[model samples]
Target chain A: MDQFDSVVQLLDSNGSVVANSQFTSTLSQSELLGFYRDMVLVRTLDEQATALQRQGELGLWAPLLGQEAAQIGSARAMQKQDFAFSTYREHGVAWCRGVDPVDMLRFWRGTMHQGWDANHYRDYGYQIIIGAHALHATGYAMGAQLAGRVGSGEAEKDQAVMAYFGDGAMSEGDVNEAFVFAASYQAPVVFFCQNNQWAISEPTRRQSRTPLAQRAVGFGIPGIRVDGNDVIACYEVTEHALHRARSGQGPTLIEAVTYRMGAHTTSDDPTKYQLFSDVELWRERDPIKRLKIYLQTKGILSAELETQLAGEASALAQRMRDECRELPDPKPSSMFDHVYADTDINLEKQRAEVEAILIQSMEN
Target chain B: MAQLSIVHAINQGLRRAMDSDSKILLMGEDIGKLGGVFRVTDGLQKDFGEERVIDSPLAESGIVGTAIGLALYGYRPVVEIQFDGFVFPAFDQIVVQLARMRYRSAGALTLPITIRMPYGGGIGSVEHHSESPEAYFAATPGLRVITCADSNDAYWMIQQAIASDDPVIFLEPKRRYWQKGEVNIEANMSDALNMYSAKVLTQGSDCTVIGYGPTVATCLQAARFAADDGVKLEVIDLRSLSPIDMSTLVESVNKTGRAVLVHEAPGTGGIGGELAARLSQACFYKLEAPVMRVTGYDVPYPPSRIEDDYLPDAERILDAVEKSMNY
Candidate 1:
């Protein structure tokens, strides 16, 4: 109960606001409702993507069923100028960053290498290599500091970076190196970890003896453990961390205690190792249901508002389904298009050779 | 014009690159106050200040990974891995992130990062210090692998590599760092051979010998010895390993009808094999015999006591040349 005992919670599992949290004054009712809508929309997108994978439309799907609050809350807390580097499982964060839902399916559909332009969204696309982008984010933050775009008094002008990884990434050398550089340089970056219990069947405890947040203390970084299922709690912690980073206080490691409610991906069968009781236990702490209960208790979730939110979610899911099904196969020659900034001489030679082979095949 | 060692030439080149572009940065372990393990970045931190010339932590992967980020942020970071063998720790970042980022982003982003490592086996100090890891990098796409054998090329190519938009793996012959030569500071890149082109250091009609990095000097020495034996061996310095100057090599092999590939790295699966295969294919009809290679044996770099035998020297190159000429 050391750090987790002090876990910041604005809303509990009972759908009642904790008497002491400051979000009651900071967040407006409309903003609270927006969080609920985003969670529902992202969850719907996740479900639709899973179904599409099952129907052989996608290569695989990594469901974000139980960690919506952690992703959406931190993402919504970010300003447009701030950059985010996320893992492959961060569909909710991508949604909050205003990425088109259909674009998210491009990688799994094998339609494109990356789903979207990182520069356009100010969000680096999902990094498949575990913990590599954590170093990238730290370097970007350091560059921001050196460029005078961060640590300035003006909040809007000071761009910070959020590097999101799972609990499993903590074990990677790149992540540890990122921690060292971020701490030593005091870079304007936040290491956001969604400790969703399992890293494809390996539990968080297997990676660490102490809490994940406590590991940051060894790096001389401030650490915070928050209930990742609590949207307000995640938002508050992330907001405070982002502020600290922008103001030149250095990096903070925030561990969001969450769970994955589905299989690791469409390719995995979690029942082989995970217990049913554990899954049922986390079902009680469903982030979406708890938020809906709070909205209903506050009388802000009217029948018409619920219908509108449900309609919006359905529309998003339908669009994802349609776009995924319509994604065309990439042109064969396009494979050599972007291996380098300028086409390499060898690649150019190979491209011409492949083109000649195709021409011959067509002629034959 | 000044007489400078390959190490000093590189230091001057780094200074010139940073002076020309404020975005150019130098980072590595002990590069700042300690200059570097080889002093290639010596006095750079003093002249440019610490911000531009950084002293990174001991982690090789961190240096490369963060350099990628810095590149994204518009800084052309030139990272140094202290030695050749130590680079494997950063192999993931170099192979996966550095080589694939530009392609993965579909040309939206470019990593103008130059990774400098003192490579090759000659000065046998200990394990990990003496190694030739160029073939691994040459095999990777989206990366440009180049090595400089002389001070003149070292003074210019380091700057050129830093200026390229694509990521460049710049390998320096650690053993030849102190070899001195005349460097014309005012000379432009056009005055020298292009970074990717192979230059014929010595021309002969009897046989063609190809080498890069430290082995280029050995091949030159072998040509000198072969000349004494009345066997004229044409020596070609392969500046770029990947996307090799095959046209030049093919033309030379076509004329000579015999070729010998030389390097300090192991013979099996080495850059020599690639050169041998390409030369064989390109000069199939013109070849007097199969292309031969003189390289280190297929084993881990041995102890310093017998490094002379393990490394390809003038005798080995001449022996391979004699075999090619006889065949």
Candidate 2:
């Protein structure tokens, strides 16, 4: 068997618990139920967003249909002080970070370039450029170290940074540079790569010959492969890496092996490139369904709990539908604002000229 | 006040800013013990320690990308690009991320970062070491592009760039690094000349000659040559490129009714082209001839032996000035 096949999995696809797993015994019943709820809610949000794009309400949407466990599990592992840097498709991560569902749509709706305060949520806004934010995350971790926030021996005081990227981003030079910097500086950062097996039309094989996690060994960091569809394993693996970072042991790379079950985006036709048979096979190992089955088998999920979750998901979807359409178009003059923190005389004059033209046109 | 070279003056400026603000950090390759390739960051690491004066890995993108992160974390980072030609590796981080962070965040985030790059040609150096890349950055909206010609401006402008809340691209004339001039260290930073405004280096009534960075010295030499010929030429140093001091240029051109722009970069898509277009529009009625340009040939920066022919010099500036004056 391939070394990549030996993923850290606590819950099998049939919903049976693996015996003698170090992490499985640590997770509480409440925590397991919480993960299930989060997975279901984010899936519903992803579906609603895709539908919105199809209905012409949004410019585009990158659906996170099957990678719910990978995103939510890793995000939930982060402490309050820890920061997260994500790609545009980490809507599940954003949900876990408490980003407003409507605010998340602003970027896709073309209402704003960025929709949330990155500092407030401890989540760096979506980075459209692949693998760019990894360096930013590494730098932020270095800052945390300079401020004496790492290896402080206090859970609430010490902090680590989480950098999220997909398998396609593995080929980018910036990402490799980020890894080099992180290792050289012993920066407190966890590199979480969700190997969704597809970089749009390209497969994982196109990006790397070996497992993506194995690349970390060349950078002198511990590499781990986790069953991305298993939320328990994903959470535990990320938690371990975050702990290592906080303790000043340096960075770790986590490759969550998952599949992208949806089109790359609303504009992409996955049927043109991807095999339907492969999609059918992945559907059987669905992240949410397996978690749901585990929760039912453990008797942690009740009829009342199911009803409550369904209602909450529908309400969240409704809120997204209502607020997405009602988003106000920004004023033309607002484009000139915040280009520079200080006064730029030339830019101000250009803004004034444009404003005058706009006023004259409106009067005519 | 003390006499200092442009290199030492910038070193003192960096020292002054780092002394005042604990959050200010210096990051680049060979910047710590090595004090940088030009020794501009000399004695900084020994005094401030390695934490503040970081010796980054020899990766331009990594240096810039990490600097942006440090700025996001509320530290003022001063990054050094070893050479002008090498800045392209970090160009995406500089242009896309560092420049647009504040605008993208709607003022919620401010990156008080200064990227110090020693630019322009004329020094005896190989390929990739001598190239003027200021035009690519000046055309970017969110960045503040400024350059220093002499020792005094180098002393004050570096500190000013570091203090600004927006990201600044500080271009230093590499050939003028060893050129000595007086620096008023006792002067108050607030009382210093406005960094965005252009200065009249030499007063004249004939054609106005404009240049910046390395070309400023050439323009001044040409003005002196023109004076020897009894054809007086006014010299103006364009300190800032992006938010150009057009008011000063327009006033000078209106007085002289002729202008000549000079730089080491290629003519097409250079700063000179933008200045010429703006000057032609601003001084159309007051002009005697078309606003002329004495820029480098639209070709790659040549080998060391032939760089003199490729670059704009005093004679080239004078030739353009003579053309404008006669026209």
- lDDT leader: 2
Q: What is the C-alpha DockQ of each candidate?
A: 0.02, 0.02
Q: Model 1 off-target regions past 4 Å?
A: A21-25, B1-327
lDDT of 2 by residue, A1-364 (tens): 7655578988878887775344664679899899999999999999999998888777678888899999988999999999999998999898889999898887776656678999999999777666889999999999999999999999899999999999977877889989999999999999999999877656787578889999999999888899899898899889999999999999999999999999877866777558899999999989988888888987899989999999999999998999899987666555556767788776566457446646765796
In candidate 2, stretches whose alpha carbon ends up further than 4 angstroms from where it belongs are A1-5, A20-22, B1-327
lDDT of 2 by residue, B1-327 (tens): 899999999999999999999999999866776677788998999999989998775467878999999998989999998889878779999999988988899999999999999988776444556789999999998999999999999999999999999899999999999999999999999988989999999898999999999999999888888888898888999999978999999999999999999999987799999999999999999999999988766555554434565577887687778788788
Tens digit of per-residue lDDT, candidate 1, span B187-274: 8766766788888999899999999999888899888888988989889999999779999999999999999999888776899899
Per-candidate Cα RMSD to the true structure, in Å, reads 18.9, 19.3
- Looking at model 2, residue B255 earns an lDDT score of 99
TM-score between model 2 and native: 0.57
The fraction of reference A/B contacts recovered in model 1 reads 0.01
lDDT value for model 1: 0.85
Fnat (0 to 1) per candidate: 0.01, 0.00
